[model samples]
Target: MNFLIEENRNLAPYCSMKAGGNAKYLVQPKSVSELCEAVAYFRSRDEKYIVVGNCSNLLFPDSGYDGAVIITCGIRGISYENGVITAHCGDSLSSLARVACENSRAGLEFCYGIPGTVGGGVYMNAGAYGGELSQYFIRGSFIDKNGEIVVIENNDMDFGYRHSRLNYEELILLSAEFSSVEGDRDAVRARMEELMAKRKASQPLEYPSCGSAFKRPAGHYAGALIEQCGLKGTSVGGAQVSVKHAGFVINTGNATATDVTELLSLVSDTVFNETGVRLEPEIRIIK
Candidate 1:
């Protein structure tokens, strides 16, 4: 496969939190073909491997991974034709949103500030500010566990709040298509900018975090619950709950995965004790 390969790579620089250890082997596939080839190669060798993009909502263990890490960030592309978008799995959701705005498509403006890739967004049904990827999803293509390509329509995606069929299916996404409405370009851009501004003002953007630490529970916001519990600015080692946004567990400096994990547990336990609600972590922890 024509892909970049590295040995003993530090994973901290890849993830948003910047607090992980290292990977024994890291492979960067530049295209869907390359990705599939690499996957097949790893499978044939019976090597444990994990595919990732952006690493925005993931936490890697300090002890590090002993397997191969395949990064699809190089497999990015976005195209729009007649109000429809076809995006590669590794394409940045934020960049895709900008492309939509440039094409005068309105529906994807909500994705403008999400710090994730199209594959991850689709897998998690990523959403914010009342809009979700499922809302515009039309169809997607992925490689299944058997190394065969499969395509699924929106109806087959089984999308829900922070959930999707990808959770149960052993599939590696390659690309996806989305439907959009024709709209005023200026209005779309304005809405995108407005949402971004709101995020900057309310979120702890200055610090290293995996965005929201916990999922929104029922009708209550995680941030509100955390703040109400007086957990803001709470710290365990170098990890702290952000004062600006109680929902985020931020890395102040030199935080370890253990520190973040411990802090998350503390915050969850404290919140549950006070509110009688158990908070679920939104970040995926890779041990």
Candidate 2:
């Protein structure tokens, strides 16, 4: 009931790639009650809706979405006490990492440079530098499709390579609790700095991308396979496979969602033809 709704909202500004078309209606609810109310309101009217976290790993089509887009970026709340970090779904991963580092925690350093909310990271089981969210997560709270809050333990999360069971379900992550061990504060900071430096050195961080475009192929690297297929630097409209890192497809200014989709399809097909192994896209495309 306390949601702000806007008409003809531009979706690009909300997303990392800045390439999406407009959303017919956009809603931003401030709290759990407001979010649930908005969901119920939409459902009562038989309207379609999509929930967006930080909008980092999504590509919205050029045709635009006809339904409501509920953005959760303003729902952030974080608390740390007794070696436990409890963060709301909208809390940034970078912020979470900083909080952990300041508290002498070591497990979350790998997420220091990740550009997404805690909820999105958990949904994707996001990992980097050989460390993943699953390792530190103790439990998560989510709102089911019926607007019921449910707590799921780490074992029930079913986290796998860049995916969790939540990806296939209609649950909306509300918050997460991570358990960390005490370590040297300075050492934790140093580790985070080193990981950030490595990310900057190897990735095309200058452009807008959804990080790795594809999951790693079996027994081989996705980027290496793309490079071997001579698909590096390939472009479709304003979207291009990054030359610096073939695993990334970047928005080189004025790119459309269609462009990104086309380039991804081309890369996947080419890689499969050359290696006889299919490449699964890591970036989620929303219609």
Candidate 3:
């Protein structure tokens, strides 16, 4: 009951790519209880619904979603005790890394600049600079498809390269716990800064785009292959393969959902034809 709900909510602004149509109904719950209440309410009806975080890696269709879109970014919290860190799903990965640094904990330096929320990060097994959330992950709580709360242990996480069990399951992530080790406070901060610098230099952060357009295929790098095929800077309307980083498809100020999707298809097809390796999109296309 304690949440914001609206009709015909525009989703473009919420999207990292700044393109998308809208949601028939949008819900932003401020707490886990409210999230569950929203979920239950929607589940009780024969309505379509989805739980989202940050909209960082999602692409809503141009036609708009005809359902309730529950955004979890409003629910956030973090804490550290006895070498263990706990964070709510809505807490940003950057905040999680900062909490670890302030507590003199290491191993989370790679998360310093990740734009995804805790839930999204864990869902995708997000990683960078040879470090992944799964390496430090302990366990998490979630709401099942039936709206029942459950705790899944570390052993049950089923984490893989850029994936987790949550990818296939209709479960809603709530809060998660991760483990860390003692480290020099200054050293941890320095590491975080180093990674952030690398990110800024390599990524096309100046424009709106899903962080990485394609997953690395087998033993080859997606960006390198794309660039090798001379697909960088190629555009389909306002969506273009970033010249700075071929792995990203950026919105050139006025891109639409159709433009981005068409560009993604073009790039993937081109890459496969030239390199013999099919590129799979990393962003979730929600139609």
* lDDT winner: 3
Look at candidate 1 and tell me the lDDT of residue 190: 94
2-96 per-residue lDDT for model 1 (tens digits): 77668999999999999999998899989899999899988999988998889999999998888899988888889999889999999999988
How would you encode candidate 2's per-residue C-alpha lDDT over 66-97 as one tens digit per residue?
99998887788898999999998888999888
Candidate 1 displacement at residue 106 in angstroms: 0.6
Q: Quote the positional error of residue 71 for candidate 2 in Å.
A: 1.1
> What is the overall TM-score of model 2 with all chains considered together?
0.97
Give the C-alpha miss distance for residue 273 in model 2, angstroms: 0.5
- Would you estimate the TM-scores of all the predictions? 0.98, 0.97, 0.99
Candidate 3 overall lDDT versus native: 0.93
lDDT of 2: 0.90
Where is the poorest 10-residue window by lDDT in model 2?
30-39
The superposed Cα distance between candidate 2 and the true structure at residue 140, in angstroms, equals 1.3
Rank list by lDDT: 3, 1, 2
Candidate 2: C-alpha RMSD to true structure equals: 1.1
lDDT of 3 by residue, 2-82 (tens): 677799989999999999998999999999999998998888887799999999999999999999999999899999999
